[model samples]
Target: MYSTRSSKILFFHITIISLFSFSIVKPIQAEPYGMAGCGLGSMVPVWKNDIGQVLAATTNVSFSSQTFGITSGTSNCTNDGIVKQKMAQEVFIAYNEGPLELETTKGSGERIRAMASLLGCPTHANELGKLMKEKHSYLFAKSNLENEFRSKEILVRLKSQIALDDSLKYICKN
Candidate 1:
């Protein structure tokens, strides 16, 4: 039979071990829409916190122009490049709204193609889509999306990747 002292010692050891183990385990969190889609990447040249502020001002001004155009019964949306850009925005929005993984699967095909089209790379869309698929993890999943530092790290890495490729380099500027 175990003595009371031994039992208490065992209980203490188990408690200590449990606490130590729990402290080391971290949950795998899903990254936010920013990293999952190129939301954060787009802000590049601009950091994370400022991206929203800048976007807010730009959106307001852009909306004012759009509204004026609408009231005047003119929409540049019908223009060739503008039409493709609208399609690209739809894809980008869909990526931000949908599950993170969906960005990898569906996006690698249509979304990338849309982006390429918007960037005037229609002929190279398929190739770009294939490359985006191949690089999805580094481009999306590798970072803890909630951490701006980590997001920026991956974004820089992604930027370098884009910079290195002629077909994808132009997006780095935008």
Candidate 2:
């Protein structure tokens, strides 16, 4: 028989392990899938239900087709989508930080035009440039300047400002 102290210690260990496991659990994604996501297993019509997740998982593990699909952009896997678009926007902003700053301050530039295109507002580039010019200080606040994710912060602020503007909100796709 275990001592009372040993029992308490075991309970504590189990509690901590359970908490850690919950913390590491991924949130459900937008796309519907069983335990196995976007692969040959997911494509199998008979095993589409929640209860069939075990079979799907087994199939995915057995074939390793998910890895191939993600890499090759096949089997319902996407190479370009919302996530990639956001990353591309962040990267573009980071690379053109100096140019964008100058263009925004002046309310126009080729870089600003390119940014508008990236944002899915190519036709409204002039309006976007004007908005950016107006919110230049807000978009590049000193606090934001010191951030590690400055580009992302800038994009957020820019989108926020566009949303606030009646004219831009309807025109900008993003």
Candidate 3:
């Protein structure tokens, strides 16, 4: 019973409504909860748009500090290590919120991981040990502690972010 022009108008209205709904509904929130459950770094640049600017700036600072260290010797490493640590701290400050921030305040695993990744992935276990000993005290009390802080941070953040209760738990196997 509908005319051709009426059918075209109905199609146009439906298209406009769907597009508007999409613009506001935020599809990224539906990303696998496993991704956002751990840390803001895994979520922000992926789920949200505004945080990329902060990430970009932090990346630049990390690269500059890392490059500066490479140009010098041990002194360069020391300076870069210090800068890298600070840069990681700043990134944590910029990205962290809610319960994740609370867990990091206790100790900073995500920050340490960010710093470790910035430091070009150490080759030897001893070297990694040395860096943790010399650099990332905020992350661990000892060089042996890499995942402790982040595990707790992620658990708490995930609990709240995903609205899970005593019935659920999220632990990273890796």
Task: For each candidate in the order shown, give its overall lDDT on alpha carbons.
Answer: 0.48, 0.77, 0.39
- Ranked by lDDT from best down, the candidates are 2, 1, 3
Q: What is the model-wide C-alpha lDDT for candidate 1?
A: 0.48
lDDT (Cα, tens digit) per residue for candidate 2, span 1-174: 999999999999999999999999999664566656766777776877776777877776577565445545676556576226566567567667788899999999987887887787888889999999999999877663643399889899988998999998888866
Better model by lDDT, 1 or 3?
Answer: 1
In model 1, what lDDT does residue 102 have? 55
- Residues 83-120 of candidate 1 have per-residue lDDT tens digits of 24433333333333234335455446554554555445
- Per lDDT, the best of the predicted structures is 2
Model 1 pairs in collision: none
* C-alpha TM-score for every candidate: 0.35, 0.51, 0.20
Q: Could you tell me the lDDT of residue 119 within candidate 3?
A: 37
Candidate 3 pairs with clashing backbones:
none
RMSD of each: 20.1, 18.5, 18.1
Ranking of all candidate structures by their TM-score, best first: 2, 1, 3
